[model samples]
Each structure stands twice: as structure tokens, then as C-alpha cells.
Target: MGFDLVSRVRLYKVLERIGCSPKQFDGSPSTPSETNRGVKQGCVQASNLFGIYFAAMLRHAFGGFREVCGDFRLNISLKKTNIMGINTQHPPNIHISNYQLEAVNEFTYLGSVVTNDLSLDTEIDRTGSASATFAELAKRVWENTKLTLTTKILVYKVSILSTLLYGCATWNLYSRQKKRLNIYNLRNQWKMLKIKWYDHITNNEALQQTSIPSIYTLLCQQCLRWLGHVCRMEDGRIPKDLLHGELNQGSRPRG
Candidate 1:
């Protein structure tokens, strides 16, 4: 196989490992396919970061680039359609009978391509200490009668509501209490998160210029770059070299 094909297959391998199916992708070799791939990957990247959806939860499966993008794009469209009309009636939601908050909490570990710095207790003022922060949030929770009176109920409610709304929850009560356990869970599962391919390529180029020749070195450098990009709330853009026709004809894909 050619280098470009190998690279594309590697990308497919990465996607496969993350629970994205090759069969469901609909992207073609032409412009339409590429554009759709970009959009579908973009949405999955968004959903991954927000702790709501999982690439693994995709209902259908595919085997190639088109299959991957088409499957995901269709699913995203269905979600949008379901939530479109105001007061639209949705199917009856299943009750959380055997739902343990701990099970769903695994999602918090899968990091997103984007990050939000908003606090749950945004209105409360923190006096610059960890203890102070907790105190303020507690005060705010108390001030909100709905929160205070139903702390227990809020726990279950949020867990259930999040699952119903987005289909996943990791900040649930049982998961919340097991800090060490959940923290560990988050660390281990992060690799399952989608790779920021374009950003990774750019950073790899920079590292190569600096004489960082090893693949391991490039991956480490890119991971740090990825984290910083996430901290700053940025989308992974296509590498300029590839766009400007600098990476040779092969790496740039031709129609």
C-alpha cells in the first residue's frame, strides 16, 4: 500500500479502537465525502468532550471511510431531528431501576476535544481556597431550595436526566463519592478518546524540525499539545502543510 493509504488506514485503526465503525462512514473519495467526513468527525469530537455521547454507542457499523462518516452523521442528524420542534413528544424514557451511578461515571474519563471552564456553582464567590470553594458551592446549593431540599433526589435526578438527555453521565453521585476510583478510571480511559489527527500532525512536524525523530517522542509532544488545545477550547484544524501542498502529493489526497 502507498503511504497515504497506510496513513488513512492508521487513522481508520485509531477510529476503530475508539468505537467508531468503518462500515457506517459515508464519506466518499470526492469533495462531498470529504466534507461529510469533516463534519461528522467534528460532531463526534464535540460530543466526546461534552461528556454526553460516546463513539462506542453508535448503533450501526461500517467498514470504510464512507461507512464511518455516514453512520455517525446520520446518527447526529437523528438526534437533531428528535430535539428540533418545541414541545416535541419524545418516546417514553426508560426508568433507571438498576442504574448505578458508578457505571455511567466512566465517561468523565474520556476527555473532549473542547473544554468549558464553567463552574457548577457559577454564581457563588470563592475566597481563594479549596475549602472556600467547597464552602461557597455548599452555600449556593443551600440557597437554592430546589437543590438543598432534594440533594439526594438531585443526585439521582441529574444522573437520570443526563442519561436521558445525552445518553451518558460520569459526574453522578456514586461516581462522585469514589474520587480515587473515578480519577483512576478517567486516567486509564483517556486513550480511548478520539485522536486530534490534524493537530497531531502539525505538532509532529514541529518536533521533527527540532530533531525529535522517534514516533514515541512525537506522540508525547502531540499529547501535550492536545492537552493545551483542549484547555484553551480549540478545535483541531487541518494541518497547514497538508492544505498548502507542502507534505508532498501522497499525504495530501487527490480526487
Candidate 2:
């Protein structure tokens, strides 16, 4: 059942009262005491175990929700509810109203497939396949004698590339992954431009003709732009806090 406006407001109030808030952490103090050092180390460990913390918090939140539902005499559909763990080895066991919720390794949310490993390989492959399918669907546009090359390129960028690059701003990419995406993009560009493999046209030449950046460059730009936005967010924001949170002192991961 759907909640009316009043019930929604009551639910929000209940959550607020139960302390269901976003997590935040500032840098640890620089005190020299042994206790202070231990506290700092514990904080670092907790940060590393994000999956555990997330699952625990979810359990608490759902417990509060159950309480609120009982108070309001509302029935929750256990059959429709499930829990998914991300980047977690052991999935959490959550119970609502004496019914244990099933844990899933993979789930779809907002049209994106998310897996427990938190790797973007599945999303990237699905997006690439969708882009290729879209390209085939628009083959007539690419081959149409009446449409100019510029028009075809515009169509591809608007329809095909947008589908492929959805949610790319938050992707964590490495060199190998970037190379794979770039190769796929280059092949798509060649196909759209009607350049055969035997044409002897290089990837750079194709990019120059299309006036577009490499897929890696484009993703980098988007990620950097998002980073700037998060940095500029208010201090209390979760993204801002996570960006500036206390991190283990070590070399950062290579791109």
C-alpha cells in the first residue's frame, strides 16, 4: 500500500527520531596518547569495512521502519522485499516482523544492475551491448543519403553515446577498463562513419573527423567534474564527508 502525505510525513519523523542519518567522519585528532591512536586506528578499520557498516545501518533503519509501521497499523509486504550486499563476502541476515529477508548477490535499481562485488564490469558490458544494438537500429540513419554526416554524428551522440555513458560519472575505472571502453567506442565510431577496416583510417583520424574525445578522456572529464561538485558541496553532505574522510596512510591506487 502507498502512503498518503500525512503518513509519509509521519514516517520521515519516525526515521529522524530514530537517528537514521547519513554517516560522516572527519579526520582523527593528532593526540599522542595511546588511547587516541587506538581510536584512530579503529576508525580507519571501520572505514575499510564499509560493507559491514552499511549492512548494520540498514538493519537498524529497517527495524525502526518496522516499529513505525506497527504504530501506524500498516502491513509491510515481506514477499516483495529483499536485501543486497555490495562488496561484501558475507551477506547480512535481516529480519522484519519475524520474517527473514532473502539476501541477493545482484539486484537492479534505477535500471542499473548492481552486484555484491561492486565492480562495474557487468554494467559496462551491458551498456556496450546496448550501444551496439542502438547503432544497428539506427543503421538506416547512418546510411541515409539525405542525412548529412554531421546529422548522423549528432544522432549517435545524443542517442547511442548517452545510453552507453549513463552513470559514468561515478565509475571507478582502471587502465585496462579504460582501454576496453575506448576500443569499443572507436569501433562504434568507425561503424557510424562508414569506415571499413580496410580503409586504413586510424583511430585518431576517426576521432579528429568526429571531433570527439577518446572514451577514457571523456570519462575522466566527467569524473573530475563530479569530484569538483562534491568538493563544493556543504560540509555536512555525505559525499563531501566521504571525499575528505580519514583515510589510511598509504599510496593511493594507480589509475
Candidate 2, residue 64: lDDT: 81
Model 2 TM-score, 2 decimals: 0.69
lDDT of 1 by residue, 1-255 (tens): 001111233344556676765553566443424422322445865444322223332333446533554444322232112111123344223222332222111112222111133222211111123234333544354244554333623542243222221211212223233333323223212211222445444433443333323323323455566555555653444443233336535574553
Candidate 2 global CA lDDT score: 0.71
Best by lDDT: 2
TM-score of each: 0.18, 0.69
Provide the lDDT at 176 for model 1.
Answer: 31
lDDT for residue 81 in candidate 1, whole number 0-100: 20
Alpha-carbon deviation at 231 in model 1, angstroms: 36
Off by over 4 Å in 2: 1-63, 72-75, 87-90, 248-255
Q: Name the lDDT of candidate 1.
A: 0.32
Cand. 1 TM to true fold: 0.18
Candidate 1 wrongly placed segments (more than 4 Å): 1-9, 13-32, 35-130, 143-148, 152-255
